[model samples]
Target chain A: MDTTQRTEQQRSADRRRRELLEAADRVVLRDGPQASMNAIAAEAGITKPILYRHFGDKGGLYAALAKRHTDALLASLRAALDAPAERRERVEATLDTYLAAIEARPQVYRFLMHPSDGAPGEQGFDVGKHSAPVLRRMGEELAQVIEERLDLGPGTQQLARVWGHGLVGMMHAAGDWWLGERPCSRAELVRSLADLLWGRLAAAGDKVGGPGF
Target chain B: MDTTQRTEQQRSADRRRRELLEAADRVVLRDGPQASMNAIAAEAGITKPILYRHFGDKGGLYAALAKRHTDALLASLRAALDAPAERRERVEATLDTYLAAIEARPQVYRFLMHPSDGAPGEQGFDVGKHSAPVLRRMGEELAQVIEERLDLGPGTQQLARVWGHGLVGMMHAAGDWWLGERPCSRAELVRSLADLLWGRLAAAGDKVGGPGF
Candidate 1:
């Protein structure tokens, strides 16, 4: 085929892949990880054969979907870290960005958070592997700020781990609950969580000698 | 329908139900909630007919298993609450009991904490509803302690919710991460959690005057 035809074919395939991923997200969110490939293909407005041609199978489709979201999420986190801001401001902005991403694509969040229940050899994607470096970088940056602001001892890494996990788990639970048929606004939910987390951090700092000064 | 025969039949049925529930737990844990009735029956050393005779169907069996575990867990919580101890000590004891229960039955703990991805109307096996009242009672009791010890006004209920969810989430996450895996003993896990919580409460009280004192 000529270069023009080849490029056109590649673009068509890329669009199809993106469409399949979008449909997979819908299926997983609406029906969960147990959603069947036939259902996903139907949702994508494609034939099952075509879906198989693009993704190989349900497992490949799910993995590609996970990887796409994980990449997007990490990129957002990196952007949050790179933006110039005060320490507290950066933390808050990063959290807000994280929360917004989860809210917008709750299925992606659920896929990452829950254990994979798919067939053997179809282990659900692992965000921990993808997100660990981002977390480490965030921790390193936050630790430096913490050291400059507080008399953090050698235990800062442990503290950061605990704090990071606590915040993540807190947001996850709150987001899950909110996703249920609840009556709270996102702003209210975010504020309640931010207050609980920031309040605890502020208290920790006060107890540990008022942030280095 | 003689009394002796009737009693024997009842005993046999009870044994079958127990076996089925235990098998269901194993199936759900090893395989996700989608484990088939045929698989569960095989695991229980019974034919499909006997499994059906015992529980009617898979949903009924799953619900029965969930209800049974939920009752046992709540009973443990009640026992902890009834133990004669100071208020703070009682809370600590309750935390320990909760941790132990989760540690002992990690699979059941996971099922109860997170909703299953089963058919619609199958996710109501909520241990949280059963435990929420117990938590509310503890919160009220703790409110009295806070009233006597701290001067925080009108924030007791909200604070209790925050503290309650935090402690529960912390312990649940710890159980998920540490059960059969972590180097820390249950006692150490409980102590660290209790200390972190109570330390925060004490410091918060110091910041705002002692409530109702």
Candidate 2:
């Protein structure tokens, strides 16, 4: 085939793939982590075999779907992190950005981060294998940003990487718990997390009649 | 049966359960997350049926094994947190205790937290169902400690809970990556994490010719 024809065909294929991913996203939003292959195929107006041919398997579909969300979320986070603001402001903004994304589409967040195993329609989807890639990627991305922006003297790279993973884990675990039990407003959650990062935990006074934390 | 006989039977049954769990721990230690029922039974010098009879299923056995390790680890953490020292020391100790446990027996930690599914002999095991309980319990335990000791004014309980989960996540994610890569010494990892918690991230200066993180 000519280069022009091949390019046109590639564009069409990419468009078709995007359309399929959108349908899959809708089903995942409706069904959380137990999104079924059969349902996704139906949503895409294709047979199961065709869906499998496109994505390889349920795990592959989930990975692709997760990557789409993770990438978009990371982009938003990057903007927040890179905003022309003070470090504290940027940190709070970044935290708020993540909390907002998870709050807005908790189903997508849950599917990407905590796909429950043994749920109906979860066959061929190994939760353990897929659960950490998003978090890991976010950690690595944050580490890169930290390394590039901050001057940490010696071992800056190592410290940035540790803090990167550590901070991501903190945000994720707190967000997961908060989503399940909305004990406070999103703003409050953001402030509290930023405060913790700001050394408030060390700054807080000990309660009366007890040793300090 | 008489009360005396019943009591003796109960004690014997409990002893058998302990024995079986010990065997399972050995197998899991050797085999990581994919430790199988067959291997566990062989380690116990008992048949698979007896293993099943004792624990109900592989998941049950895993839960028991996880609880044993988690309980021990938590006790050590509690000691560290409650140590009669300055808050920073306690934090470092707690961090060190957790890091040491995971580092010493990465296989057990992996089995408890990141059990891979879809491996051979993993038919009924569900990684997602069981993965979070340990982290959840640890978060709750830490939350209690923070709430009891720290005076954060109004909304302290909620803040403590968030920080509890967040800190655990930070420690966990950092420890997981560190364990895998050993980018730095355990002492270095603990110090960096403590630094992050103590507002070092906010205190950090921007690298020359770049916006700060």
All candidates: DockQ: 0.08, 0.60
Q: Tell me the tens digit of each residue's lDDT in model 1 across B1-213.
A: 499999998998888788788887888787655466777888888778888787765545756766777667767776775566654576568768887887776666656544343332222232223223333343344434333333334554444344444445444444544553454676665654454444332222111231222
Backbone clashes for every candidate come to: 4, 0
How many Å off is the CA of B210 in candidate 1?
A: 36
lDDT of 2 at A62: 77
Q: RMSD in angstroms, all models?
A: 10.0, 3.1
Candidate 1 per-residue lDDT, tens place, A1-213, comes to 599999999999898788788888888778755566777888988768888788775546656776677678767876774566654455557667776887787666656654343333222332222222333343344434333333334544344334444344444445544554343566655554555544442232212221212
Fnat of all models, as shown? 0.03, 0.83
Tell me model 1's lDDT, rounded to 2 decimals.
0.55
Overall local distance difference test of candidate 2:
0.85
Model 2, residue A13: C-alpha shift (Å):
3.9
List model 2 lDDT by residue over A50-120, tens digit each. Answer: 78777887778878888888899999999999999988899899999999999998777877876754354
Off by over 4 Å in 2: A1-5, A8-12, A35-39, A42-49, A117-124, A211-213, B35-53, B56-58, B117-124, B211-213
